[model samples]
Each structure stands twice: as structure tokens, then as C-alpha cells.
Target: MADDLSPEFCAVLRDAFERAGYDADGVLRLLGDSAHAALGRGEPEPARRAARDSGALGSLIRLFLLGDTLPEREVRAILPWPESVSTGVVRVDGDDVRAGLDVRPYGDDQGSWWVFADLDSDLLGGQVPADHVLGVGHASLSLARATIRRPVGSVLDLGTGCGVQALHASRHAQRITATDLSPRALSLARATFSINGLDVETRQGTWFEPMAGRRFDQVVCNPPFVVGPSRVDYTYRDSGLAGDDASALVVAALPEYLARGGVGQLLASWLHLPGRDWDERVTAWLPGGVDAWFVQRDVADPDLYVGTWLRDAGIDPRSPEGSARASAWLDWFAENKVAGVGFGFVTIRRTDSEPRIVCEDLRHAFDDPLGPEAAGWLDRIDWLRAHSSPDALLRAHLRVADSVVLEEVSASGDEGWEAVVRRLHRTDGPGWQHEIDELVRALLAGCSGALPLGDLLELLAAAHGVATDALVVAALPLVDELVRHGMLVPA
Candidate 1:
């Protein structure tokens, strides 16, 4: 890529950003909490008012973020890097200076970093170009939060837009390679890595082509998984494949790129067809010898999905062109017998034993930064695999997760008061809630991590006047399900 972005220029840029305190915290401080929240909602007037009197940080925010032009002298005073103008980072028209690209502050719990990408379509007052590289967005952040961020020897960020995923991977991975089909995207990714002072290898190719014969310890992809007609209008969202094929292609090809025991996490979309189970369709995409978890976060009908993506490209749904596009999209959906679209996270880990794949819809809001939960889930899968037999499971001690809470429901009837329902609720990590019967409830109450599960089951069987073998057989599967959902854990 960006051949003009020399190391010296990037180094100078990083230093200038640090000196001016142009970071996540710095930006928040400059624009009070209200104004910052307003800015995130896409209303810039509040931020504009807040920055009118602020100094260099204000000008920096205006130039890079708010898409405002500033006095050339003021920009030069703050940034001594003459290469910015020479390299077309900004255009100088007489006494005015305007940024040519978008540079914003992004960070996690660790520290702050900068992301470089093309200006937003709102700033441009038009649809983005075909090869536009997206900055940090909801999908990218979702994948980042959902990734299992264990320390690894190497990582692969497939279809890295502005290298946001790669940037987060740098915190734990020893080495990383970011790839994309668009050269402009790769160029921006390279610039992002350079400015962050991270040693990431950038390659240009589609999907796995850039990393032929290479296996990575971790692979993270946010592919062009938008489901629609087989037409390519934008590179970031359209895969030019009909009806969710892009997502399926990536999932099918993942096994070849992951090393044994390595993990791959990606964001994907799939279609719901009439009389066909969505989970089964997606589950069939995975090859053998891998444990997978699919969490569907949202579902959109055809009309809503089409309208949302159309407006995302700056097209008004009422416009003639928008109407024509929608008609064609709906026609495609009708021909394909598509019912709806499902979007969510997919985490797969290569394994040596028989694979365990769980697919379910988790639409409830819960705690974010689910990386730790994801890692714990993979470990629990291994533990369950090691103890697949009844005897092995009975010999182990189990405890309810600290975040789990028990709720009992009751109603007054002719017999005064009677229990109606009982449920176990996990307060964190997707907040899964499971209804239980008296037997299961009693069994969970006895799981204080003090005795073996077999002993506890034996005690429950004696109290309930049921056979020990029968209770054990019935409780084993329930315990396995609870462990998988993070409602229970090993002592």
C-alpha cells in the first residue's frame, strides 16, 4: 500500500498525537460527557459547540473527526509534520486545511490506539466508494469483544478493514498478519499498524489466498457477510455471492487455516429458509473435528434488512432508486425462499476428540468484553470431553457459578400457597435462564463443591425415593447443559 506513508511520518504523527493528548480519554475530556454521548449518536452540533473555544485538541477533533476545515496556520502550529501535506494527508487551500482521511481514537481496557480509515459517508455527503475501508464499528467491536484473547504465537486477521481487529490482537499475539482483498484497505491497515508501532505483516488477497499453506494459532475474520443478491456494489458489505454464501464459504474454509487446537472467531449472517432449520444449515457448514458455538444476536425480516442496509449506503428508502433496489432485492429473496436474516458471532476451535457444536439464540443483553467467558467455554468443553462417561462425571465436584442466581415463583391457590416455577438465572455472560423441576433444583442446592456429584445424587435419590441409577442418568445431561452455558462450573 500506502507507499507515501513513510515510517518517519508515522512516527512523527504518533508523537504529535501523544503530545496533544489526542486519545480516548483526552477526547472525552475535551467534549463533556453529554456532548460525547451526543457525538456518538451521529449528532455533531453538540460537539461543534463544545470545541468552538477549545484549543489544539479541539482543532484536531474538528479536522479529523468532525470533518471541519481549520486555518492552515493553526494546524501547522499543532502539527509540525510537513510530510502531512506533502503526502496528501491534508489539503491546503490558501489559508484553510482539511483532512483527507478519518483518524480516531480507539481503545480497550489495556490502552489507547488510533484507527485510520476513509471519511464517513455522512462527511462526504454521498455513498462511500466501492473500496471504502470501514473504521471501528459495532460489528468489528462485537467480534473483538467475543474473541478468545489468550496469548498465542501467531494470529491471522482475515479481511482486516482498517486493522482494528489486528490492533487488538497485538496485545496478546506474538506476531500477526492482516489481509484484505482491497489494496486500499490493506494500505489503510498498514498505516494503522505503522502509526501504532506494531509489527504486523499486511498482505493483499481474498480470503485465505494471502496465507496459503499457513496455519495460525488464532484467526479472526469479519468478512463481507451481508446477505443479498449476487451483485457487488461495495466491497465492505457485498460478497457478490447469492444469499449468505459468503459466510458459508468462510466457515467451510476455516478448518484449512487453523492449526490443531487453534481457534477461529468470526461474525456471520445466515438466512432462514422455509421448512429448514437455521441452526442445522449453519451447523452443516462446519467441517469435522472442531467445537463450535453460534450465538444469534439479532434477526431481521426481509423488508427491514433491505431497508437498513440501503439507508446505510445513504439511500433514502422513499427514493426511486432505493425503491428499485429494494424491489430487486426482495425479488431475489422470494426466488430463494428466504424467510429472514440472522446475524451473530461464531467461535470455532479445532479439537482432537469428537466435536461439540451448540447453536442457540441469545437475544438478551449482558456484560460485554466476553473474551474471558469464551475462553472459559472452550476450557469447559475440554473438561466435559475428558469426563464424557457417567463414572467420570459422578467422581467430579461441581459448583454453581458465582454469577448464577436462583428464583422461585409461587401463587396463592385453594391450598394457600404453592410453588409455580423455579429457575436458575445467570446474571452475566448472556444471562442465560433455565427452568428446573424439584429434582434438578434439589440437586443444584446440594452442589456446594463439598462432595462428589455421585454422593450428592445418591443422597437426593434416597430422599426422593428414586433409584440412584435413574437419577444419575437423568441429571448427567442436565448438568452438562448447565456447564456449557456457564451456569455451573467445576470446583
Candidate 2:
């Protein structure tokens, strides 16, 4: 494919996209009509990966690869992006309508992509790990940015697809080695490294194979977490396993590579056993000596779970083979004690003691504020575990490693407003709203940098006219926060 846009497609693509109700002008402005022109002709596969991860720009690139008459709707449909319009142009319905900004999207040889990390083109392709089944996307950046607070030394990205996560760590780690089982991916990763001039050690091997005797400071992976049948496809969603046990196997075998104080964070899915708690089932995956933060976001019951993955793999359940495959998935779950299936994020750290493993199922959307709050989450958990209740409080202003910005406003002169924040410990009750009980207590106890956490709780509870028992319960969670922020060091 030519690097320059040809005259033949430049005009036709613009006309067709405009007719299809896309913000043809604005889309072209960012990607450049020339870029669109190149896309209309479609670039070589080698260049497509970069395009796919470019977010909005990828959409325009998508329009080009799909053909001149391709509708803007179709391009967005592939990834289910949200409908958006700018430049006084009419908007058309796309698949999904997510919100954000400064999200530079570009179309390279790989696939549709959105840029979350400030990536240099030289660092792509060859820097990619052999384990990647798909090109890098925004998800890797989202995960990477969300983990700034966690300690990472030698990062081990299991199934390091396109080395997206590994590449992100180049700025954070002393060194990075991205591993993948696919040679093609490794080749591309090498090119990626050379292209971006970013240094990364790329290896060809599955999971921890290439890094046998070595360990990393940080490991970030977005493995094949989908629970699906063993399909021929092994790059993106499909894993080479009977069912989705590949994710479990990866999870079960990952702990050995973690070094002291190192952390491994991955996105995974697991079968939900009927007779067992999902937590217990996941607990089985832990190999001891690691602290884990496991959040199960959604649970798809038997039939639904099986069908979703089947459909996700582009298989139409209406077909006979597809129906049979769905049945097999159900059977697999039932026999394996799986009640359903779940999807979400998992973060683990190699601690000195028997790791404090935490499991939570939060069915919620992960958006902006989510990335910068890693520090708050790390602190929140610490605060919860150390004390029965917490008396410490945080100013709404947040700063997570350098990625978060907390804003606070007060009404005119003597008044102020703050965002009371908390990631629910268990959705036990009222975790989202500020539990002013401790806030009031802490205020009464006086946050003078000297009063013990306990004294604050006792004083505040007395003023709020609340029952002492109830006050005690609330204080415990807050105290846990204090220990987490290092506001109260461990005794």
C-alpha cells in the first residue's frame, strides 16, 4: 500500500462518508484527508494495527479499509463505539457512544486503535510481545494508568498482546520484556520497537516461558479472558483451551514469577461454580504469598454466559454448529461446578506474608476518574484492613502517581464543597455516599495531626447522636483507609 493518499480515493471517500451522515469534515480534519485517502485504498496489514488503536482516527481509517461506499455506521459497529458529531455536521448512530477527550486515535497497519499513552511510532511492531493475539488498544493504557499506585519491579505481562502494556511501562520501569507465543507478533513487536525508538526486550514464548529464570518489577496483561470454546483463533478473544480454562490455567500458574514487592495485574474471566462461591473458586487460583485485588464485574448465568461468548466469537447461535457449541459450553460449566461466568480486573502483589487476598464483584462502568484513583483504592483497602474503623479523611483533591486531578469548590467565601469518594468495599450499604459519621467524628476528634484515630471516632459519634455500636462499625472502615494512605503507619 502506498504511504501517500491517492487522488482517486480522496474525493470519493469524503463524499461517501458525508452522505452516510458521518462528520465527514471533522473526521478528515484529525486524520487528514490524505490519511483518509490512504485508508480508502486500505494500507497493508502490517500498518493496520497502528490504525486500529488510534481511537477516533481509527474510525476514519476503518472507513477507508472498508471500501469507498462504506457507511460510517459500519466502521463504528465493529467496536461498538458511541455516536458523536462535531464541526456542524450531522451525526449517525454507531455501535457505542463513549465519552472522553484528547484521545488521539490513529490507523496504522494493525487494527483500529485509540492512543492513551503518548506512544512514539518507533516503539511499535518489534516491541510487541510474541504472546499478543491482537494489536494494542486503549484498554491496556486504561489498566496501566489505573495501576500507578501499585508497586512494580519486573513486569510480567502474561499473553502480552502487541506488547501494549509492556510498551506503556517503558516510561515507568527500568527495563521491559514483552513475551508472546506468536512469532509473527514478536516480529511485529520488534518493528514496533524500532519504529518508536522505545527500548523493549521482546521474546517469543507462552506466558512465562521466555522469562524462565528472570522476573520483572511490574507485569501487566490483558489475556484471553473470554470463556469460550477452543476455536482456531488464538490472537484476540479465543484461547486454546477446552472452555475458558485457559484463563484459569494462566491465573493458577502466574504467581511464581512475582518478585518481592512486585505486582501482576491482568484482566480475566472465570467459570462460576454453582455449589461454590466464586471467591472460593478463584481462591483456588492463588498459589500463596501474593496479595490480590479481584473484582468480578458481571455474572452471566449458564445459557446466557455460553451464548455471549459464542456470539462474541462471531458465531451465530442460530446455526446448528453454534447451538451445539453453546451446549458444550453449558455442559463444561455444569460439570466444572460453574454456576455462571464473570469478567473484570485482577491485581496482585508479592507481599512478604501470606497475601491478603480480596475479592469483590462490582458491576459498574469503568471510566475516567477510575484511572487516577489507584492511589485512593490502594489506600482505601489498607485503611479497611488495619483498623476496625477509620477516623482519617481525604481532601477531595486527588493525585494518583501523576495521572489524577482532584477538584474542590466552595460556595462563595466561607463555604466549600467536596466530592466524597469511595469505591464500595462490598456494596454493604451506603458506600457510595459520604459516611459523614466518621467525617463528623474525625472533625470532633480534631484532625490536628496528633489525635489518635480512635479518639476522633469516639468524639464525633457522641456529637452525631448515633449509637456507639453503629459508630464503631463505621470507624473501622475509615481507620482501614488511614492505614492505607500511610497516614497511620502500621504499628
Candidate 3:
């Protein structure tokens, strides 16, 4: 484990990093796109080759990122060697210096920062310890991108491994609290905060325990959501709870820690049972008085899921020990009758009115951050709720969202290039697509924000020789759905 450093030392360290240009852009520029991407994929030889002639930045990347040992004199030229050694940032063996922990540059649209975590198992040349503090990885980045980034009074980073989410939250949140089950994780989290000059309260406890009576305006979590047997192999990935219970517990307990109108976002995995609807299984986990959106980004069969996690733990599925572990894991899945594992994002907001819940599979690629879309979705829900009455909905004027594009598909048939399907596609955010019929297409075309929805519906009804009431009845629900997804916006 790494030792803590004083705030002054941390400030000095931050300055050294800044002066050496050891941040994301600096590293990327040093390594170039190909080598940097290769490093991101955990293949460091390309980065090593790229950094050979680079200066202090190269030494920093080699020592910290590639786990290379440098001459003490060389490392001393770049860092405050005495303080870095005393604080466990690096260790000295003879005349060589090596990083004691993993420190890497992480940034977003806001600013640059460094994350502290345990060294990779590959670098350690062994399995990670039980209390391993994970660095910024895919799931953590996904949650950070998906989080609604509006300014808030307070934010809680539950299961804050290495405080990555808290680091992002610090940009917008006035007060931030980060919690984890492992003391080592909390220690590294505190260091991460200190080194970044961020003021965050760090607590060591299980999910929601440290947050007993406190509530936050926003909570972001990337918990131990890997579904598996109730055995603890690693603290960062295993909750020691049977099958997705850890995820369930966190989701169920969120309402208590969330202030009224507060929002919570997390990356989670849920079981796909033989007969149960996957969406329904997740929907049942929602508590009352909260609006939730569950988007399943990927699904893996039992074997694939088990193999992925096993490899993540540094186990070869073909090895004897790995085979035995795989068999036991497979048996557990069979016993539970789990068909597949669904992994996705879950965003829930505490509400005072009738709760609106949406559960669906969104496996498409997105070009925009989900944070803005998430905030907009909640606001659209509120708009729909306020206009629940048919008359109220008809009175409002709406226009097609700027990001929406109408796509028409055609097939070569007997009639030659006949239109088969027409859909409304959102160009950004989640990239939601909705198929539409003639009536719906015409309604959207006429939605120029020049007239109330009711008047537009009546006009369409008159043009189509349909009853005005019937057209209004069919159009209201469709308009509501469109608005809920940001395909349409209030004029």
C-alpha cells in the first residue's frame, strides 16, 4: 500500500507534474496516436518505444505507466525525489527508482487530473491483492460520461475506487463525499483528492453505511456490479454477495441517500432469467417516488460472462485451476437459471410526483455525452407529467429537435424502390430511433412550432378525412413519447 502525503507535498507534486507536462495531452502528444492507443489497450511496448527519446515526460510515463525502473538520478531530475520516496510514490532499490503505485493522467471536458491506484497485476507479476484499488477503467469512464453534470449542492461517489468519479464531480459539485469498503481504497482516494487540490470528504464503509443519515443532490457509483457466486476474490470487483445482489442493494438503498429531486447514476449488471423479462427484473428493483431509466448496453451469455471476468482476474480459462473455477461458476449460473448477463447504465431521480420508468436495450453507438441527455430526459418527463391531460398536451406547441433526422429505407420490390420503413433517428446522445407510419410522419413534418399540437392534429385529421377526436387521441401519446426522448422540443 502507498503512504499518504501532506497537502504541501501534494501541491509540490502537482506543480512538478504540471511543469513536466505529465498530463493527458502531453502524454498523447509524446506517444502519438497509435502508441498512445496501444498503451490504452494495455500493450506498453509501443509506448515504450515511442517514449525512448522523449524527455522528462517520457521518464514519467515509463516509470509510472510502463512500470519501468529508472536511474535514481534521472527520476530525481523530474520529481521531488526525497518527498516522493517518503510518501511511497516511488521506491528506491540500490540506484534504481520504481513507482510504488499507479499514477496516470485522466481528464474530461473540464480539466486535467491524476488518479492514484494499485499497480496493475501484470506489473506486479502476480494476482492483485484483495484490497486492490482500481484505476480509471471503462466502467468508471462510462459512468462519468453518463453522469448529469449540472451544478449541485453536494455529490456522493459511492464505491469510489481511486476517486475517479469524485474527481469529475469536483468540477461541478460544491461539496463532494467519496466512500468505499476498503481502507486502502479510501487512502488512495484521499491521496487522489489531495494531489488534485480537490476538497473531498473520504469515508471507509460498505455501501450506504457511511452515508447513514446524509443525503446528496447527486450520487454516482460504479460498484462491484459483476454478477457471480458469493465469494470474495477481490474487493474492487466482488461484493461477496450472491448474483447481482450487490447491484440490487445499492439501487434499493439509493432513495434514502438521495435528497428529494436528487439523481443517482450507476453502471450495473443484472441477470437474464429463463422466463423473466430482463427489463421487468430491473424495473422491480426500483423504489417508489423515483423516475428511472435503465439502458442495457450489452448482453453476454453465461459462458462468455464467466470467461470475461475470469480473464479480468488474471486467470486462463484453459488452465486446470481456471477450469475448476469456471466449472463452479457455471454450475452456480445453471442453478440460478441465468440465461445471460445484462450490463448497462441506470439513472434514477427522486421525484415528488407519479414516477416514470423506462427500461430498454440501447446497444447503438453514441457520439455525444449522455449527461445532457439524462438531464433533458428528466425535464421532458416533467413536461409530459404536467401535460398529462389531453387538452393540456394539445395546447402546447413543439418542434422537432435539432438532432433528429428522418431516415427512409427503401427496398427494390415489384414496384421498384418501394419505401419499406421510415424512422426518426436522433443524431446524438443515445441515438434513439423510432419507426413511424404515414400519419406520424405527416404530424412530425407539420410540427414547425407555428401551431398548437391540437390544431395541427385537427388539420391532419381534416386532410386525412379522419375524426378530429380520433386523430387527437392517437397523436397525443405518440407526441408524448417523442418529447420524452428529445425528438421533439417545446416551441
Best candidate, TM-score: 1
Each candidate: what lDDT?
0.89, 0.51, 0.89
Cα-lDDT of candidate 2: 0.51
TM-score for each of the candidates: 0.97, 0.60, 0.96
How does residue 303 of candidate 1 score in lDDT?
95
**Per-candidate count of clashing residue pairs (backbone under 3 Å):** 0, 87, 0
**TM-score (C-alpha, index-matched) for candidate 1:** 0.97
Error of 3 at 396 (Å): 1.4
Candidate 3 residue pairs in backbone clash: none
TM-score of 3: 0.96
Residues 17-94 of candidate 1: C-alpha lDDT, one tens digit per residue: 888889989999999999999999998989988988688889888888788989988999787557888866777889
Per-residue lDDT for 1-491 in model 2, tens only?
Answer: 11111233323333443443334344555456556566445343433544455554455444333211235554444422232233101124454232211122333223222222211212221222222234434456556655553444455656665556655565557667777776655554544443344567777776677878776666777766666556544365566675557667767666667777666777777776556777887778887777777777677887887676555445678788788877877776677666667776777767675457767765765444333344455555544444322333322211122211223332444355434442212121212222333354335236454555455556676877777668767555554443343333332
Instruction: Give the runs in model 1 whose Cα sits over 4 Å from its true position.
Output: 1-3, 80-82
Model 3 clash count equals 0
